[model samples]
Target: MVEINSLDENDVLFGVVASDRKNRWLGMHVDHDQTPPLPWWMSNPNQMPQWTNFLPGESNNHEYHGETRVQMRKPTGKWNDVPCDKKLKCICEININ
Candidate 1:
């Protein structure tokens, strides 16, 4: 099991592949089991939207090297996904349970 950490608005997440999601909204799907966004002093706790690049059985962008961006963080620090082809800085959190 893996969870991509959430970021606050204006919070920068490095190393992300650029994605061309329609309207630049980022590829998204309804995932009921995804973790909630992190809560900070100024961050809102009510907006933990779950999103993913790959939509199974759905047509999607197959651009660059990575058509499906597995893990990504938006510059706004919100939950988002990007193209896996673009290379950029990113952070990973590993927890042992």
Candidate 2:
């Protein structure tokens, strides 16, 4: 998996290599000019940080890319480790009924 600031072919290639080396997706290539350290709120020592939960009124749109191996975000803005295709990107919906 890989994450880039923008979807450029070159950036995606680099991110893939970096992800393979680290065995996890590093959102935004570390070589980016303005790459920032992972925030304290997202830190996890056991495994890659999985995006979960949503603050009230948070925007529904996101620019994230690459494999969804770790978490899948629901339309309601809650993320969980639901199994899905390990593709470049995907959207999963569940019927509450």
Candidate 3:
């Protein structure tokens, strides 16, 4: 997936080359830049760094884009393995009784 700062025509074009998207919706593209950091009370006393996604040795279609994947938070409060390039939010809520 291509994660861009904003949605544009290029997203559609890239999707076509990514995989077989035959009349299927991939879902909305969102970027969550307001994720809260770890609270001080339960934080590490020693040196701590912000959450980041990195590929120790993963492959990507883009040659220049290596390692250093973007962070994605899912509805379940879990980090999802999505292309850091695609500007999309991972969340889905359905009420049930």
Candidate 4:
């Protein structure tokens, strides 16, 4: 995930990579940018942005495009099994110092 500064004066930007099944190249971009109280998308669902569909034993067939890939799974709890398209309330945090 790439962390960036938010365009807004009170926000901080966070970028993450997401992929589809078969480990194909999907896309990369910022998930959200907000201020203090850290966005729910950060911890609530525990859905850290990551590259998906990376099945083991298939790395030989995978191509490296110089993009950083991290393995992340959906959080198991109230947020588990929720559709990605569903919208939910979230918060954002900013460093004071």
What lDDT does candidate 3 reach at residue 79? 26
**Which RMSD values do the candidates have, in order?**
11.3, 15.7, 14.0, 15.5
Residue-by-residue lDDT tens digits, candidate 1, 25-78: 232322322333121111233544343232342222334233333333343233
Q: Could you tell me every candidate's TM-score relative to the true structure?
A: 0.28, 0.21, 0.20, 0.19
TM-score for candidate 2: 0.21
- Runs in model 3 deviating more than 4 A are 1-67, 89-97
- Output the number of the TM-score-best candidate: 1
Between candidates 2 and 3, name the one with more favorable TM-score: 2
lDDT of 4 by residue, 3-66 (tens): 2223232121112212221111122222222221112222234543332222343222124332
> Please, what are the lDDT tens digits per residue for candidate 2 over residues 29-65?
1111223322111123334234323234222223343
Looking at candidate 3, the ten consecutive residues that score lowest on lDDT are: 34-43
Ranked candidates, highest lDDT first: 1, 3, 2, 4
Q: Give a tens-digit lDDT track for model 3, residues 1-97.
A: 2222233432443354345322221222222221322211112224322332223422222454332233223221112223445554322223368
The lDDT, on a scale of 0 to 1, for candidate 4 is 0.25
Local distance difference test values of all predictions, in order: 0.33, 0.29, 0.29, 0.25
If the candidates were sorted by their TM-score against the true structure, best first, what order would they fall in?
A: 1, 2, 3, 4
Clashing pairs in 4: 35-92, 38-91, 38-92, 38-93, 39-91, 39-92, 40-91
lDDT over C-alpha atoms for residue 8 of model 1: 33
Clashing residue pairs in all predictions, respectively, total 5, 0, 6, 7
Top-lDDT structure, candidate number: 1
